[model samples]
Target chain A: MRVNGAEVEAAVDPRTSLLDLLRETLGLSGTKKGCDQGACGACTVLADGERILSCLALAVQYAGREITTVEGLAGPDGPHPLQRAFIDHDGFQCGYCTPGHLCSAVGMAAEAARGVPSYVTADLTADRVVLDRDEIRERMSGNLCRCGAHNGIVAAIAATYAAGPGERA
Target chain B: MNPFGYARAADAADAVRLGSAPRAAYLGGGTNLVDLMRRNVVAPATLVDVTGLSSAIEERPDGGLLIGAAARNTAVAEHRAVRARYPLLARAILAGGSAQIRNMATVAGNILQRTRCPYFYDVAGSRCNRRHPGQGCDAIDGHNRDHAILGGSPACVATHPSDMCVALAAADAVVHLRGARGARVLPLTELHRLPGDHPEIETELEAGELITAVELPPLPPGAASGYRKVRDRAGYAFALVSVAAVLRVERGVITAVRLALGGVAPKPWRARTAEQALLGAPADPATFRAAARTELAAAVPLRHNAFKIELAERTVTAVLADLAGEAR
Candidate 1:
């Protein structure tokens, strides 16, 4: 499997979660593990461009997939647009949940762009799903911010999304 | 987590063969199984990964849907066909876990997911009858605010935790299974069993059975369906009480209705009495309330969850009223 644009391989225990393999064996400690259980979004990562909890996923099950962690969000220029947006909007208090929040917001932005509906989506027949404050909050509910920095997080995501994809770099 | 041998199955048949091994369990999304393993609630020596078997969501020849067992919760909830035809199912799926958990959870795993009873998950608690038969149920006298109110035996008071199964029961879906013996189909309502005297045996699946697909029948032409879930919080929490309702009305008269309640029973509580009371009757709040009363008459709530009786009644009435209003 590829990790952060690099092809990596290792013999891991079948019972080992993807979060464990990434943090322990691959030395990609950018992805924090708040709760080894799936309740917390601290272990959020992207597999095949979709957001999934790495703690519940077995490393062996994701053999041939492209695994992207928080470290993979940066480009040759600097931090990703969402990361920069977080800094500009002050989206973190304790900064423990920033990695998961950044990755989750990236996936949430992609989902919104694809017109995917959240639980609060009223009109299922609509071709475009509007990403208002309620939509962003509901979509990001999985990622918990114990420090209660949700307002700035939502603002950063909304701002980054409004800036279009090409303006990110 | 205890060390376990892992084997990936090639197909459904191979999955059944592998699953028949002693102390072997099927691995779906690992959302619940891995959590349980970490808590030492269950320790299977072997794991059979069945995610590669089938994951398609195809339309059946009879205008129904055949949802593969391996389909992810997020994929099923966002499926265009599911949203159009089975909105109740889509809403129920979305009402469950957060976005990340939904993306990883599978339909089959959701169907077979265990209860969220805190006592059942407590490794140190020795009073869970579901974990150890003939022992005792601590929730019966302990902190049981989230326990069941209906269809609970003295031995156990836990509730099934899947929002999707409640919708499936109201939709009259069929669960397709493949076992070492042969293929068979069971109605969604019959898939789960009441605690009765044995809370240990939750489902009717045999030793080596693997859920293949769930088939949903076509809805009536003018029928309207929806699901309503009331929980402790706005996000990522189990339901205190949930209702799934499907109704068809003509000229203000109820032609057909199907009702199911969750978080109130060990299995999805099919409100047959309520459905019977509403058929051929006027579609009004009075009638809906009466039906709810008739169905909730059988409730035997414990110490802490007695309020669920009133909550279930109001939920049922509201869901029916919404469906009836839409049908009109």
Candidate 2:
């Protein structure tokens, strides 16, 4: 099976979730286990370039899919633009929920490009849900921050508004 | 988690065959099932995977919508026809668990998901009738804030957590089930039972009876529906009080209405008294308040959950007001 674009073959339990594979079996500690349950977004990762809760995802279900963890976000040269914005904005304190927040923000940006509507979308029939404070707060409501870094995190995301279009749907 | 044998059911017949086996459970998205298994809450001997079945949303020629059991919550809520015909269902789904969880969670699993009582999730052998039939209930006098206010008995007080289910009950949706015997349909309102003596038996579904589809018939003209829920937290939490209301008005008078409540009952609480009060009455703010009071008059809340009565009334009024506004 391929993970994060690499081909790796090894034995794994059928019941083992993707989060277990990342933190325990494969030693990808970047993905924190805030709740183990899907309530908290601390264990989020990108599956086939779409954000998903790794804690609830079964590893066997992604036998031939691409996965991207926080550790895999940085290129050989440096961090992604969103990562840099996060640091510049001090978007993390304890940093437990940062990975999930970052992944969720990336996905949110992509969703905005695709014209998906959040609860904060003022006009229900609008082609795109405007990326505003209220919209981001509502869309990212699932991702909880223990240190109350939501303001900075939202700022970091807002700072990248001009980074051009991202993946949609 | 205990080791449980796994079996993949290729189709409906195969699933029913496996379900007939003693202590076998049907696995859909595994969002709730896996969580329960890990906590040792449920120790099924065999898991029959029913996710492989063709349970997509199918549009009936008569303009009704048939949601398959395998359809994910996200897909069902986002379906074009569901949005146009039944916005209440879509709003309820959006008000449920997070997007990632919704992506993997199926409509069938949402209805069948077990209780959210903390005592039930307690793997340290806490007293819970739902977890252990003969054991006592710690929530009777404990942290009962999230407990039910209606259709509850001394045995249990855990509230059903599905927001979508509340809307389904209000819409008069029919639950489709498949078993070794054959296919059958039960009204969504009858799918659940009061706690009474057997709190362990939550829904009317028999052992190994798999839910295949849920059908929602076309609503009457001028029919408007809305769901309102108030929780301790804003999002991703179970409701402290919730109400789903569908109203049809003609000539400024309420023609027909269906109302249901969640997070305040063992099953979705249908506000029949409220509907009866609203029938032939003018659709005004005062009339809505009177209907809400009538529905909540018989509510029996525990010490911690007494606040739910007021909350339910307020939620019901607010939902009705919104529907009335949409009609105008």
Worst 10 residues of 1 chain B by lDDT: B123-132
Instruction: Name the lDDT value of residue B253 in candidate 1.
Output: 99
Residue A20 CA error for candidate 1 (Å)? Answer: 0.7
**Local accuracy of candidate 1 as per-residue lDDT tens digits, A1-169:** 9998899989998889999999999999999999888877999999988899999899999998999999999998888988888999999999989999988888877777766677788866466777788888888899999999999999998888855522342
TM-score of chain B of each: 0.99, 0.98
TM-score of model 2 (CA atoms)? 0.94
lDDT, candidate 2, B202-261, per-residue tens = 888877898999999987777887777688777687888888888887788888788989
DockQ of each candidate's interface versus the true one?
A: 0.76, 0.44
Task: Give lDDT tens digits, candidate 2, residues A24-85.
Answer: 98888888888877788998887766677888776765666788888877777789888998
Candidate 2 lDDT at B107 equals: 83
Q: Name model 1 segments beyond 4 Å from true.
A: A162-169
How close is every model to the real structure, measured as TM-score? 0.98, 0.94
| Chain A TM-score, cand. 1 | 0.95
